[model samples]
Target: MKHQKELYKEAMTVLKATSRTFFIPITFLEKELKTTVGTAYLCMRAIDEIEDDEKLPNTIKAELLHATSQLLLKPFDRNAYLKLLEPYRHQLPEVTLRLSDWLALCPEGIRNTVASSTSEMADGMAKWASKGWHIQTKEDLDEYTYYVAGLVGTMLSDIWLWGAGIKTDRELAIGYGRGLQAVNILRNQSEDKERGVQFIPDGWTRNDLFQYAEENLAKADQYNKSISKRSILMFCKIPLALAHKTLDTMRKGNNKMTRKEVEQTVEEITSE
Candidate 1:
């Protein structure tokens, strides 16, 4: 658990330093949701690493995924899993290096909480990614994202118990995670399609990505309204703002449009 704190710090540091777009929104959730975000990122990144590893043989990828599923029941398999990532280990120095940076900014107690939580998250993620390629239905997508995103929602609730910072509405917190995952689903629609993965619910399509984006924003309404404190609401506005920006683009822009002019239009809308 102590070591997990170190790993958690490293995860956040890497994300904070190398990722500009993710920095601000994450900061808003810093105290409570920070651990939630860090652990979620590690889990999501593991899936991304496996799926995005173009250099690995397909069988190895499948095997790794399978191993990951086994690991969910035994999280210490992280060391073994990390070993499997040997080929790309050199490229991952920053995941550790950045931890040092984030550690410097963290208070001791919060750091420990972040660490234990993140370690569990990393292990759970490994377990999930091991089966990440098994998406056969929309329900599977929800379960998967719940493993990847909604779990973070529950964690956000846990972190909130640490202080009286926000209204801490559980429904809204759940909404936050769903909305964020919805944003992720929409943004990665093309890439996900290329890989035979679909995170949107049934009856949705690339053609309806924008419509689904609206669904995401609609999903967020409870969360946005759940904030009773204006100050906290203003601070919490970051993720919602990003969700709105993402959904607004989805509404006005054609995700399937590949023409330079059309893509540019989408990009322009997304930029807002």
Candidate 2:
């Protein structure tokens, strides 16, 4: 077995390689919180890669996600886990295949939470994959977002309560998660269309999606205000700020923030 230190290092490498947007903000988390959150994020990202892979048949994708969820629930079983994931290893992003390292290093409490959330997310993804990823109504959009992102909010809130002794409103955390996912949906509208996944409700305009995202962002702001610790608040604020900026850019028909804008926003949020 790899030492926890080595596993942690591998997890951090997966985190940085897979999510540059989250990497900087996650650094503001306190030591243990950082490790737990990083592990959780990487695990979720692994499932996400499976869900998002266009080349894989939906049945294969669903099977992989289901297997991953089951692996996370058990004690770390390197041989079994690797064997299960091996067939699709080349199809998934290389960073995502490091799930064993992340799972090996996760603390027990954090591990359980990560397991539960990822299992739930995997089930949701498998269900949606069977549905052909065709999100047709407002309700379907909300459900899909909850599966992919709102659960993340709940997980992070739980982590805050556990590690920082800070309680957050679960509803608001869900809203915060929904808001970020909505922003992503809007930003990736073109790409998702190309990939045959349409998150937009039938009869909804771009403006409608923007409205949905902004309302959720409003709740995200409330989520930030509810955090008592400066470190946690800062940790939450940076991403929320960037999400807001990205939404604004999207509304203006630009799908992204420039590097300079991202740096300025990060500096502004962290300086407060």
Candidate 3:
């Protein structure tokens, strides 16, 4: 078995390569929080890879997602687990292949949190994938976002409280997660359409989606304001600031933030 430091180095490598946006705030976390949150992010990213692979049949994706969730709960079985995951292995990013390693490195409480949240996300993904990734109404959109994102908010809140003693408003934290995810949906609207995944309800224009995202962001602002610790506040603020900036840029028809812009935003948040 790899030592904790080696495992953490591997996790950070995967995190930085796969999700630069998240790496920023995660880096701001204190040591234990950093490892736990990084592990959680990598765990979710693993299942997300399976769910998002366009080449896989929905049935196969559902099976793999379910299996991945199950593996996280049981003791690690290298041979059996890798065999089960092998077919989808090539399709997923390298970090996802190290899921067991990530699980092994998590502190017990955080591991349980990661396992439960990942299981819930996998179950939700399987259900939605079976239904053809459709969002037919406002309720459907909310449910979909909750599955893909809001549960993440709740998981993060649990982690924050456990790791740092920071109590977060679960409802507003869910809104924070939904706001960031809504921004992603809006930014990737065309790409999602190309993949036959329609997150937007019928009769909802871009403006409607924007309105929904902004309202959630307003709540996210409240969620951020509730954090008192400097490290935790900065950790929360970096992403929330970027989400707002991304939404603004999206409304102006420029959805991507330049590296300089991202750096400036992080610098501003960390300095405050």
Candidate 4:
């Protein structure tokens, strides 16, 4: 069995590799909270890799996601999960394959909460993948974002309250998550199209998506302002600032922020 400290180190290494905006802020967290957040992120990222695998058939993706969800819903069963994913080992990433380790990394008291949230995300991803990600209407877009991102906000909020006695408005929390996801959808619109996936509703122009992002971001602003703890506030501020800057950059006909631009934004916010 791996020591707790080793698991934390592994989780942080994976987090640093996988995320551009989240790593520094997550690393800034105090040790226990960092482990919990990092573990939850890897757990969700594990299933997310399955959802985004181009080589996997939609049915297979759905099967894997649903099975992962079911597995998470029960106790962590290393043998059952490894057997379920064995055939697709070549197709899956390390993050997906070592999901059991991530789950085990969560501190025991809040492990179930993290597992339940990740399980819900996996189930939602399965539903969309099974339907070929056919987002046709505003409602469809809302539901999809809620599943993929809004739930993340709720989960993080729950973690905050549990770990630090922090309280936040759940609706605003959902907006914060949805806002970040909208920015990603806007930035990745072309990439998603290349993969035959479209997140924007039919007849919706780029401006419509921009407006959607702006509306949610307004809520995210409120969510950020409501956070009083400096450490947590800084953690929230980094991504929200990046998302806002990304939206502005995208609106100016840029694809996304340059690394320098991202660094500048983080520096500006952290210096404030």
Q: For each predicted model, how many residue pairs clash, with residues at least 3 apart or on different chains?
A: 4, 0, 0, 0
User: What is candidate 3's CA lDDT for residue 28?
Assistant: 79
TM-score attained by model 1: 0.62
lDDT tens readout by residue for model 3, 94-151: 7667777888888887788888898889888888888888899999988988989998
What TM-score would each prediction reach against the true structure? 0.62, 0.96, 0.96, 0.98
Candidate 4 lDDT by residue in tens digits, 13-111? 888888857897885688888888888889988998999888999999999899889999889898999999999898788888899999888989889
In order of lDDT, best first, we have: 4, 3, 2, 1
Clashing pairs in 3: none
Q: What residue runs in model 1 are displaced by over 4 Å at the alpha carbon?
A: 1-13, 26-87, 91-93, 96-124, 131-134, 165-167, 201-203, 206-216, 228-232, 254-272
Query: lDDT, candidate 1, residue 251?
Result: 64
* Full-model lDDT, candidate 2: 0.86
Would you list the C-alpha lDDT of every candidate in the order shown?
0.54, 0.86, 0.86, 0.90
Q: Find the 10 residues in a row with the least total lDDT in model 4.
A: 20-29
Extract clashing residue pairs from model 4: none
| Cα displacement (Å) at residue 84, model 4 | 0.9
> Could you tell me the lDDT of residue 107 within candidate 4?
89
Off by more than 4 A, model 4: none
Off by more than 4 A, model 2: none
Question: Clashes in candidate 1: how many?
Answer: 4
| lDDT tens digits by residue: candidate 2, 115-171 | 788889988898888888888898999899899999999999989988888899989
